[model samples]
Target: MVHKKESINRKHFLKDVFICSLGAYGGPEAHYSVFIDQLVVKKKYLKEEELVELIALCSILPGPTSTQTIVSIGYKMGGPLLAFLTMLIWALPVLIIMTLLSFLYQFLNQNNISSTGLRFIGPMAVGFIIVAAFRIGRKVVTDKITILLLLFSAFITYFIREPWIFPIVLIIGGIVSIVTSNEKNLWTPVKLNPQWRYLVAFVIIAIGSIALTFIWDNRIIHLFESFYRYGYLVFGGGQVVVPVMHTELVQLNHYMTNAEFLTGYGLVQGLPGPMFSFSAYAGGMAARGSGTFVQVLGAAAGGIGIFLPGLLLIYFIFPIWNKLRNIKGIKISLKGINAVAGGLISVSAIILMQKSGFSLENILVTIATAGLLLTRKVPAPLLVLFVLILGFSF
Candidate 1:
């Protein structure tokens, strides 16, 4: 068992986080699988149960679920400092790639570069989600009530497909678990000394940024406010946030064309790490007036702005999570929450598979990817590289 408060090696933990970032393609659902493979299974930094709790907690909160979940793990390992570094290491590379891609979009267009080489990534991600669903499902689905809760959540989310549905379903799952369970004396109050300073900082930045946007006619301030708001307001993951961004950046502000925004999004899909990194591309493109430096600055603003609130929330809440979990009611509810989370992952694989197409080759790639992952034979990065090569070669 990994002990909290510096019992773990900070460097090694950060290195494993970097590895997860490199292999974390797709959105949050698929990203969770990569976390499972690398952090829980391979590294044994935390047990599968702890990871599931983190996932459920992050899902209920706003911002990037996978990113927040990993940060929570970092928080568990070595507190806030390590958590900050984990967030940076997990997201910085892809943020950089997305920022550069924002500039390279023109070059790619000029060269008529085909994105066919990224064709298999979607299917490969589905494979990861499938394995994740299976593994998490086996652990979470222990009883009839839990099974029903899982199915109910999966069915609801699959059909609804909205940002609000996720938290609502998870809340319902917890409530149902509590109502139906036969446990007595579930209320045990533990003192929670939450760090209120972090929450105050979160609110101050949010309000201050908005106020600054109105007071000053600066593009960077406006971009930071916009992206920061997106960080806290949007639920689910990058997929949900993208449309809000498109509407604001494309339709409202005319920062870039729909084509440009979509192009950057397409590029982000092939890159590993948080989908929120697409904000860098959009912010850079939006700030495209003075020079490359200004654009890069905009990208920096975007990357930091979008991730900051979530980090702050983690800072405020995660310290008390263990205390909260000590309540027998909370512990009982987690079973349902974890099962519902598993169902969400399961449904994601189906949704992604439909989107990627049901072609024979796609099916084969997904099956092969899942098979390799299950066997623990091929490393994720190597698997990703091999798939990219196949996409490029044939």
Candidate 2:
């Protein structure tokens, strides 16, 4: 008994978790999502529902839910440092593999682009996001306020199509939440209020990062900026990032073609690890015109760049999440924010389809793929593989 206790005590929660992450595969659903849940449960690290709660919270937060979920678990097992380390471990495999794929593509005729099946991923990704939005939104859009915010956000976003609009939409939701929510249930002035400080610090860092982009427009900085913006701002999964990153990397920078973007986007679906690993592939494509070394560096920057903001957020926010969650006003705000996130995801599907040319076939695929996912019968990885086969047949 003592030996078992000692062994448990000696467990390096961070290292153990990190090692586990290296083995996670099949996007968010297959290995990453299931394995981590099992690990945390077997280790007695957290109650099953507790992890579920964390995941629910992460779904509303932004970026990759799996990444933030691991960070939160790591933080619970260790602390801030462990949380950061978990982010690195989670991303390392993806960075390496994506960079390698980038290097390999140099030998291939990217111009001809034979991955015809992979290109279908773009439309399917659109459908995937729509399905996800419905699933998430159905849970959060409880009343008129949330429904109004959801529709309002989606309407403005569909028309304006501005990346900056999301944060403003969220701010409006927060304000509406405070104004409309039951005042009696709000948390009273406690010993300390750190929420404002964290928000201010986050804003300053974001501004500083943007300023640095202007001052030093280097290869690395540019890669980071593109991904950092997407990683920080995007609320849903890869479905949402597809459109946002497309604008920043393709439309704005002209780093790669639409076909190239879709290929990588689809490819990541089949790959093991996080959904954001596609950024590393994008990083590679961005610098495919350059040397091998530069391509690898770009891949690293893209992977780290996109992953960092959310890593920082979960680390900073998770500790206080418990305190803030209980406040009625904050919960109301989160409800609104969740609705907005769903709205953003909804618009993203539309944006991706438009960017993909809005073909009848693409529309049909979107509907079919969305239907497959909504059934919840098929695993996402298998669905991706099936799509790959179908991509070839079609």
Candidate 3:
């Protein structure tokens, strides 16, 4: 009996470690395997079908599907503590890497090592942005109206040279959708936990900001503020956040040159994790001239600022989501938002394509990639590898 108990404890320990590691990697597949197996198979508390339903629900919601999926799973398995643990695990790697990179960039900047790299970053960045736009457009635009909206928005944005145009378009699109469609109940408040979660998130953020302020002596507060605000306000996905981050970091704070920022953006597109990791690159550049500690501190602050809002939003909104799930107006509003989201992505793709210098080779590569993505069971990383090889050879 004693031997069996020890073995059981060991198994549990291993299982927890595995789950935590998987959680640290924060992707849909990772979340599915690690959290699902642990919660359903090992715990044996929830049904498989229920787990599937939960996954589907998370998939439909905006934001990182994997993070939300894991959060839901953790909530089911062990309430708020587990949820926080799962989120922290998923966020840790990027945070650490970004922090380190920020420190390195700061050191390099002090020695003027960044200038040489900046030149090559420009054209590459344009290409990257174009690719991003193409990726988003291909996924979002299905209908004629959405296509029109995308084109109109793109033209207005390019011509007006205004950043606010995007949000204005979204709002107008939402209102137009409500007005034109014969659907009832077109607006719904997101379901949220009591204000307590928001309070907790705010407090945590405040403490972090204060701690960073004291530690780094507020050297890069602008960068920190921009990231924090962007993370908090950004509603759509990674692509939507791109423009906002760009405007703030490149245009507003002047932390990074356009070329440098674009290059970092391109690199991020090729990475496995969230686009928010771009914060690390930006923060690192911004902290140039600072010592290692300052660099890491800046990167961590920027990265956290970028992601904190999303985390808080999810925490606050989860409970309310359950309550509003059955509301008719909420359903209609979601449908409209989904439509607008699709349109927004399409617009982004067009902009990116123009910037990427789409040639026959790239077009063909994109089509092939799209086909693979739509039909084959291959993973995204593998697909990216295949395209990279093809692009290199062609």
Candidate 4:
């Protein structure tokens, strides 16, 4: 269904982007593996070592790994404009679907018809998170230090219930590595790649957003800042972004209730593009308080804000990726960051599990869902729909 070795034209890129988006619609692993095949196996776009470098970069940055990887490769192959267009193209489908799902989820919220569905979906999302933790953990946590870091990260995240805990955990891990003389290959700091315009713009936008948040207390500003912050901080893809958003939008701001967060989280599981599109769903839910006009604006702001920074960062960084990879400091810090990411993800799973209100019956549902995922018997979308219907029917 995917191939390379021939010169790729613009038409082919678009076609491949569309096809990859469809393939990813099934689940995170599916989308990523499909993309990996497209990039590494079929296209030979990037050598294995180069691809690993990109993977580490994605792991350190925020938002979805697959989406970021796609953008990074596109930027490398082309440039800033191409990368932006590529991300827009690859994410357009999911952005639309998630927006529609947001409308539906909002309708369900208003009518009270889908609580049961959300009930099933929410815990099942925890199951998904559990699967994600296992999948990523097995890859990253190979030593006692990482194991201890995972536990420590989880303990702090679960107890602190604050967003700063993320950076704090990363810092702690980095310091520990430095102190322990764990001169392993982690994030070796490097001179940020040039593209002075993009770099300056990124810095300005970041600072401006932060400054705006402090000066103004409007709904739109708050919403955009929330999305931007989540986009910047979340290291791992999809599932990991959940807890960060949970704390900011749900717990702190009351933008969405637990029900709303879990519902959006569970629902986005079936969307075809970036998992970050949940920001649209969340924005829609929050905008329910205002009229339709504000709702649409919120939706656009949420989705765009969630996506823009990471795209900028990836595009700007790609030109110098070769040089950046050689920095020993960045390499070691990345190891710390990755370890913290694993632990943070684990904590998010626990939080979701708790919020799902696991009773004996819920237990059965969770175990069954996890088992099904483990077996790989059904596609992700179908499995989600099955649970969704089961929720509505029961």
Candidate 5:
């Protein structure tokens, strides 16, 4: 009896360790959508309908739903530090991978062998982007006006190509929506917290970040600036971050090659977690030749840059999200922004099509993928997995 009891205790200890480590290591590998769904089902003690409703609400917002869901779960489980730790774990893997990739690319460029097998990734990536645009467009665009906006945005973007156009269009749509108001449920409040501590904490964190930037090296400063702007200023979701980062890191700072950026972006789409991991890849590559300390610092900075803003927004807004839920103006604005986001994705697809030099085979694949996404009940991650396999095989 004693031996059996000791064995049971040992098994329980190991099981706890495994779960904790899994949570940590699985951060980058964790699918934000899946994580949220499972947590609600297993841990939150929520019913199916409630889980669905929660997911729907999260999905409509600007940030990655998966990350937001996890943060929410952590907050519910253990408060702010747990939320922070969960996000930190989720971001760590990409940080490490991206830093290494950056070093490898730099070394390869120096050796002139960079083109050996990497050249193919570019066109393949364009194909993936084209597919993504179609997938997102089919769902978000329901009416002719939305379709026209999408096509017009694509055409304008293909030629003129300014980074700020995306957010500008979203804001314009929001303003127009507010003016055209019709919904009656716009101003109803759904309260979360009434205390001001969350807001105060956020301001303090921002101040600390600013102070840190001054004390750190230039690379660290650049990382903070890039992430801080990405988190705070970015209005739309993951896709918006791309253009913003391109403008800042690629066009302005010249931190990464266009090929490296796009490749990392494509890989991110295929990955299980949030798309923000692309920042890790970019930061890692950018940090190369700066030595080990700089590399680690750069990677950490990049990870923070990608996720901190959305996390902060969630914390500060949670108490007020329900209150603002029924605000007619906000709903209209969100609708308008969603329309613009659809347009942006559609435009991106068109660009990908041109760049990929689309053939019948590629066209068929894209059509099939989009059709599966729209008409069928296939999940996004499963579809992504299928495409990744298909992409490598073809």
Candidate 6:
């Protein structure tokens, strides 16, 4: 259902994006649930199958998977312009908030702002993941083979817990499905007019930024290079990027203290939106010695740098992906790919529950959150706000 330019409700779409940003907590795992609720169920912007396919596609990509998935939705709904707006709407507010929060480290420390108020959030996010896994699982698990694949993917991911394991599992699942399936005549090729210019732009910026950093010895350029590298090189989302950032920002360059880096990370976990927004906080801290203006510049550079590669890559690849779907082979493969993706989400619930703990209160919060979401009587944004308020009250 492609919309004409004039027919697309740009305002409505952007508003939904903002609402998602405000309520998007946890990392990509939990963010998928929010996308399913707001974008898939409520808005009917896309089907669960299409969204799952996007999830599978983005999971194979290197950057923030949830961010890429949402951006792809915008591209599908409108065009590149709407996709750009989606990225901004989904990430900018938290970026700005994180940038400002970089200046509040001292105040937070002096005032003893414990993250206690945010404790329930982790379990709440687990709730979201549980519901998403259930919903996605119901849609994707169509046969005995798919059920086994789902369980296998979840079990393997739960134990291994490595970044590279994801794409490998997804690919293996795809191959397995194709080999075992009854579908014949699945490999017809279609002419693909991929926009290689976006790929060129991505590569040029990557190399250019690195070379410029070497030649300039400027702090801001260095920050951009570091983050742009992070955006492309890392497989998993913020969890994987955190250690890399810690090594570079704290240990290697001494850009910031370990304590400061951890503080920024903790704060980011409490806030809504992409976890990549932590880049702004780190970049701001990295430029703290320079000046206020430089710090803000550093934040903007970091925000843009970390998200740029993914945006470019998605823009370049999405069109090709859309075309490729016309191949019967690709359609057949989506079943296993989506099944494995569902498994990935399923394992995340277990991992997060372990991290969040198995206390009665935490379990109750998770149960309550999942229950309310399943009931569909409450809006996600309101549910999120209520949970935050409840957490703070405790």
Number of backbone collisions per candidate: 0, 0, 11, 16, 13, 0
Candidates 2 and 6 compared: the better one by TM-score is: 2
TM-score of 3: 0.68
> Highest TM-score: which candidate?
4
**Top lDDT prediction, candidate number:** 1
Instruction: Give the per-residue lDDT digits (tens) of candidate 4, residues 178-253.
Output: 5565566555566664777766777787789889989997677778877877777677677767778888777887
Error of 4 at 354 (Å): 1.8
- Candidate 6 runs further than 4 Å off: 1-6, 106-190, 324-394
Clashing pairs in 2: none
lDDT of each: 0.81, 0.71, 0.56, 0.74, 0.57, 0.80
Instruction: Flag regions of model 3 displaced more than 4 Å.
Output: 1-65, 102-139, 142-144, 160-163, 185-219, 342-394
Clashing pairs in 1: none
TM-score of each: 0.67, 0.82, 0.68, 0.90, 0.73, 0.66
On residues 181-245, what C-alpha lDDT tens digit does candidate 1 reach at each position? 98888997688898999999999999999899989999999999989988987655676565457
List where candidate 5 sits over 4 angstroms from the true fold. Answer: 1-33, 41-45, 107-113, 148-163, 188-197, 200-217, 235-237, 352-394
lDDT tens digits, residues 241-318, model 6? 654566567756888765466556656766889988999999999988677899999998889999999999889989
Instruction: Give the TM-score (vs. native) of candidate 1.
Output: 0.67
**Model 3 / residue 93 / CA error / Å:** 0.8
**Error at 17, model 5, angstroms:** 14
On the 0 to 100 scale, the lDDT of residue 31 in model 4 is: 69
Please give the TM-score that candidate 4 achieves against the real structure: 0.90
Q: What tens-digit string does per-residue lDDT give for candidate 2 at 48-98? A: 677777876676576787888887877776677767777777667766777
Q: Is candidate 3 or candidate 5 better by lDDT?
A: 5
Candidate order (lDDT): 1, 6, 4, 2, 5, 3
